[model samples]
Target: MIVSITGATGFIGRRLVQKLAEGDHEVRVLTRSKENAKLLFPVEKFPKITIAGEFEWKDCIQGSTAVVNLAGMPISTRWSSEVKKEIKDSRTRVTSKVVDLINGTSYDTRPSVLISATAIGYYGTSETKVFDERSPSGNDYLSEVCRVWEAKALGVDKDVRLALIRIGVVLGKEGGALAKMIPFFMMFAGGPLGSGNQWFSWIHLDDLVNLILEALKNPSYKGVINGTAPNPVKLTEMCEKLGEVTGRPSWLPVPDFALKAMLGEGATIVLDGQKVLPLKAQELGFSFKYPYVRDALKAIISL
Candidate 1:
């Protein structure tokens, strides 16, 4: 199937595009920087990739079978007022635009499916509570942002099979949480972040990309699906597994207060988290390549 993706230059987007192209699917990258997208998916390397300019989003969507929305600002930063605005706007605004482009297309021409990325932040930080796709959304700042982000996506016509993936902490090499933690572990100074009791609901990058692919191709994948592994470990346990995989000791700990001081409101992402499970995905018979934290850590860190 032909797929049009927004934020095609992002971490998940990049991997998803490559996997889709490898499966002989035509991919249209609706991006702000055609040159950058070109560099990332060069014609010599990816002949099926079409780097659509900023103005060609509608044209691209009309010709595609599905559209994946992964565009968003990095939230792992100091949450100043301006940064917060950027974080919210980047997801909600871009998603609104994508929906509008899809809505404007004729029924026969518009994409049949829309797979959008929301985060587990939608459920807020809850160490005690377990969350599934059916759970109610939280009332935190990030929750509001995700709520608005998904609301914008809901603007798509009912004919579109909308799949909103509430992604958890992504574990992978080169990027995601591991890149920041692995260096400290390699130097033998790594430990759990914050209070260490927070739930660390995570998914292997490969599994996440596969989930998106499944959502894109399977009509049964409509509605909310938690993009997380079945096993949800606490931050302390996750750190222990990381330490084991990296051949280091989980001794030192980053205090919650210290992290709060450094990242401000952004600290909630690491200091507190919800235990999200892939209930919907499992119901649909989706398989996770790396379900356990220890094994997931080994797959990434060992590489």
Candidate 2:
């Protein structure tokens, strides 16, 4: 199968591309620069991969079996006015362009499926209950971003089978939330941010990649699926797990006011949390390798 992917150089995108390549699928990556794409994903070893610049969408989508739209600005940075606009534009504009290209062009050789990425932020920070695919979206910055992002993706032509994955915090050995917290945890400085009672929905990278692969192969897996572990742990539990995994005592806690002062509104992502469940994915026979936080933390820290 031929696949076209945007944000192919990003943390999750890069891993997803590698998985697809290993599965013997041809991949065309949309990048800002062909040179940078080559640098990120070497074409010599993986000749089935093609790297093209931004405007190559129409050409790249043609003759593809699937398109995974993961292009977006990182939300972890401080949300300045400019940064917020970049985040919105990068996701909505690029997605709109891809949808137009697929619907307007690609008629004869159009991809059969479109897998777009979203976030658990779609549910917002709910202190009361767990959110599933059927739950209504929350009203927050991240939720608003997700609302528009998913809307743009869903606007794709009715002929295509579209799947939106509302992803949670992805735990991985590389550059994810866990990686950044390891050093602090190792030094026994790890503790919950803010109140520590907020619920956190997360998924291991291996499971996340496999979930995408399953979605690619299963026609029944359409619509919104929570790309998260079934077990949702509290923020305090997460901190405790990290501390235990690293054999360090979690003796410190970062106050909500301090976080807000340092990160501004962006601190909401860490200080506030949502409990999300991958109910649809589980019903569709998707199993997580590390459903528990302790095991996931151990696996990542051991690496």
The lDDT for every candidate, in the order shown, is 0.91, 0.88
Candidate 2: tens digits of C-alpha lDDT, residues 1-303: 899999888888889999998989999998887888898888677789989887787888988889999899888767888888898889999899889888976577998899999999998887788899999988877889899999999998988999999999999978777876777776767888888989989999888989988888899989999999999898899999888888888769878887788778788888888899999998998888999988988898888
Q: Which candidate leads the pack in lDDT? A: 1
Candidate 1 lDDT tens digits, 83-136: 999999999889999999999999889899999999999998787898999899
TM-score of each: 0.98, 0.96
TM-score of 2: 0.96
